[model samples]
Target: MTLVAIVLGAAVRPDGEASPTLRLRVEHAVALYHRGAVAAVCVTGGVGRHGPAEAEVAARLAMSLGVPERDVILEDRSRTTVENIAFARPLIGVHQVVLVSNRWHLPRAWVVARILGVRASVSGPRGRMSTSRTIAATLREVAALPSTVWRAWILSKRSAPKPEPRAR
Candidate 1:
């Protein structure tokens, strides 16, 4: 089966540079490619408060690291977790996916993948965020869990087809 790795992007720097978190995610995705576990890498995220689209930056980084150009699938329009998954679905054919993001962001990312009908597992490279930033992200994940779950449920229901009426 084809294995697609979804690498979630982080905020960019004011100089149009990738933050450490984004670099780590790109490294992780490239490592997966080197291991031959992932047939394709889907870079997901749009421009943050600064810099270019996260996916585009990530794709460039991956190419710089020797990942084949054709293997990098850019989902540059996604500005949120849900949008990432939704936008990536049509481009990725793999049901079993490996998601790459910051550790604090894994739970919500996984929820988004499930909402988009992907069976996924998550991994994060080392994080360099400050203590306060890490704590804030963790708290945000906790706060977002309820809505994420609810959205997943709603999405699943909507994707399921209706049964035909029974004849008397």
Candidate 2:
């Protein structure tokens, strides 16, 4: 089975170029490809604030970084992190993957991926951080977690078997 790398996207510039966050995501996926850890990369995102499909920018970057064209699949209709995993599910099948994104974002992305039945491990770039940025992003993540977990719980309940009715 092929190993896939799932790279989530961020907003781009007005000129339809990749943001630093998105660029790093693409780079991490490419590095994983070079290391033989993954055989394909799925770039996931729809139109971001800058108006270009984020996956398209990522695919271009991946190709520029030497990942073969055939191995880079664009999932270009997802507007959110959950959508990223949900949209990539069919492409991924049962393959294992390195899920690439910023450190602060991957936890929620991982949670959503599991809910969608994708097997993945997180990979973020190694870098120095601004303490303020890290704390702010983390705080936002914590605020978002409850809704994601609640969605997981609700979906699980729906799939579970109903209990037998008690006798009158």
Candidate 3:
């Protein structure tokens, strides 16, 4: 089975540098590439307030880590988590995807991506995790749960095909 790594993006500084979270995502994706676990990586994000497009930063980082330029597919028009999955679906085609992101961000990402029509799995970076950041993210995710579910419902409804007309 073809497995494509999905390296989700985070903020980039005005200097066009990736955020720590984004860097971690790329690192994980690159590791997967080296392990032969992934055939390619799709880096997703649009232009942020302070930097170039997040996908651009991610793709560069992956390439620098020896992921190879040809193996990195940049989905550089997604400004939201929803857009991330929606936009990547086309570039990703029907490949099984392993998504890399912060631990606290994975559940919604998995659910949202599946609803958006991708077969996906999630992973957080290996090694030490800051408890404080996890706490903060956990709280935010808890708060966002209701609205996330609502949006998923609406999106699912929108993606559903309309009934075909009966024979005249």
- CA lDDT for candidate 1: 0.85
lDDT of each model, Cα atoms only? 0.85, 0.84, 0.84
lDDT score, candidate 2, position 165: 100
- Model 2 per-residue lDDT tens digits across residues 43-100: 9999978878999999999999999999999899988787777677777665467789
Ranking by TM-score: 3, 1, 2
| Candidate 2, run of 10 with poorest lDDT | 152-161
The per-residue C-alpha lDDT of model 3 at residue 48 equals: 83
* Per-residue lDDT of model 3, residues 1-168, tens digit only: 898888887899878999877898889889989999899999999998966999999999999999889899999998877778777878877647898887888888888877766788887786355788778888998788778767866877887789999998
Candidate 1's residue-wise lDDT over 1-119, tens digit each? 78889998688888887888888998998998999988889998898898699898889999999988999999998877777777787788768889988889998889777776789
Off by over 4 Å in 1: 130-132, 155-168
Cα deviation in Å at residue 64, candidate 2? 0.6
Give the better candidate number (1 or 3) by TM-score. 3
TM-score of each: 0.87, 0.86, 0.91
> Which is the leading candidate under TM-score?
3
For residue 113, what is the lDDT in candidate 2?
A: 73
Pairs with backbone N, CA or C atoms under 3 Å apart (clashes), candidate 2: none
